[model samples]
Target: MSAMEGDSFTLRTGLPEIQRDDEIEWRFGSSRTRLTRIAVGNITTCNDETFRDRLQLERQTGDLTVTNITNEHTGVYQLSIIIRNKKSTKRFAVTVYAPVPIPVIFSDTSQCALSAERSSRIFLCSVVNVSHVTLSWYKGNSLLSSISVSDLSISLSLPLEVEYQEKNTYSCVVNNPVSTQTRHLDIDQLCQIDCDLCFDSPEAVIRLVVSALISVAAVAAVVLLVNDIRRFGRTQTMKR
Candidate 1:
């Protein structure tokens, strides 16, 4: 009467041992990464049912093989072993998460549509598949403030202040447990049209006045020439 048990001498708690040139197949990635290590219990001793002879029980460590892991290889896995006409099995679980991608910020700072008075221009932050992401604004590499987005998406309105608008490099860092992504926003001064100098200056006013005077003089001269020709024709007709 031989009884096989997880403990007492038939199976030991440890990694499987393999001989030279022996094929050891370690399966992983049913739902997660491969196994790094495994723990097993001591062996259990037992007697055969025939009772003709004493069946010596010996626990052996099973051989394990590892392969390179990838993102798609995420899932539960199991380890199986066969010893002396008996089979045993164990189970493990795994989880894989995606890394965060780089964060991009878009701002409306062109001169065509200027920001409203006393209001900041809107800047949008966009990240893909980063649910519940935390967005932190920074000047250079130093952290300024962190804000949590309740939804997957949110827009940040950045007022063009004297200090911040002049900064050379403004950055946004987005992070999660899996990964962190950062992006830099360059704030440049809008190419402006100086209305006081270019449009409403002394030179511009003088040019406008000269153009109006030339137009009036041309019209008056044309009118007087037409009247003089008509009066000369009438006097010649009376003489004839």
Candidate 2:
């Protein structure tokens, strides 16, 4: 069984009911420390400091629930049941994983436009403050690259290079044992190479727009002036 940290997880007993004369015990962790036990109509939970006030053992069905679970609570859990003096054992493997963060896709060339030397535009897929997760890049449902980390997987950013005219779908995904998050690529938005960047500054862009607008205004003024001159000439000819 797998669960996310801070969420409650339950281990089902799979029994319809527990008889009044049965003995049940649940132990957890690497040391197999005794956590809770029920015997002949009596229930008791041991103070295993790590799981204090978090272990709930159902009296009717012998189900065990761990509340507000954390990464520390991930391990093997053992359930022991004794009925009619016959002992039966069942074991459960529980893993608590951190919440997977949404992967981010951004153009690596944002700081500078692509140069003539660069054959392909670069984009990066990244995640932050995450652990125990695999980060992968997919091109049209096909896996291109993947990287995983043992503890902190935030360093597992993946990079991809493609042509400026790339039209194929791409996505980045970050996943753990229990959760996943994905981000899709927008080629037009992230992989674009604006020729206007050749001007090199925001002021240059403003100047270009202003110059085009002035040219349009000058053309319109010239057309109006020519019309007025023709109208005046027509009035003089009619008076003659």
Candidate 3:
């Protein structure tokens, strides 16, 4: 079944026809006093469809599509088939739940290390409008773990660590009584490498400073070469 932005879901059923003189009714609510909604298939028989009646057992038949279904629409739907005055019923239950939202990623930092250097990413998937909760962690599309934290206000933390910091995606899913939420955490090890590769050695500050100056000079020379080529192209274009 697929759901849309609105609180709607469509059910595709395999059963097409019910025996003659039989009726189908959708029932819901665990408690009898809870007030449930019933949308019967409005059964009618014979070729002309003349046996249809709102009440009384006049033999019902037909296919129906129920729309605008709400939470109260959830419950047991039974098909009562009557043949030769003998009746048999079959029932199915439905539960309505909202779609899970995208989670928010919160972390103080986004770096980690493998051999000589290290980085760490912290994340928590916060969700609302839920009662009992279950949390799951994922690496890319694969499931890592699933845990239950019944209280809604409780928080779930996921820590990601790796060797030789690189780009990795971490996902967390939060499922509750009312809805579900998911969030992703991304850590770039290449950036951490940039941090390490761009820094100076404490023991040799003078040499580090000289090395830094040389690197800047090299970058500037490359930029100047590119600019000179662009200027030469423009000059040739003007002459042409």
lDDT of 1 by residue, 1-240 (tens): 111111111222255563333221233443323333322334322232221132232223453321233333344445555444355666544333344568776644452234223223344556655554577777777777676654444443332233323545667788754457787765442222211112223554586688889999999999999999999999999999
How do these models rank on lDDT, best leading?
2, 3, 1
lDDT of 2 at 79: 94
lDDT of 2 at 86: 98
Candidate 1 local Cα displacement, residue 118, angstroms: 3.3
Q: Tell me which of candidates 2 and 3 scores higher on TM-score.
A: 2
Q: Which ranges of candidate 1 are over 4 A from the true structure?
A: 1-72, 78-93, 109-116, 119-122, 131-134, 145-164, 189-240
Instruction: Please write out the lDDT profile of model 3 over residues 23-117, one tens digit for every residue.
Output: 34432235322111222434332221211221222222332333445444556544444445675655556555445556565433323222223
Q: State the TM-score for model 3.
A: 0.48
* Candidate 2 lDDT by residue in tens digits, 16-88: 8989998889998778999999898889999888899999989998999999999889899999999999999
Minimum summed lDDT over a 10-residue window in model 1 is located at 1-10
**Candidate whose TM-score is highest:** 2
Q: What lDDT does the true structure give each of the candidates? A: 0.46, 0.84, 0.48
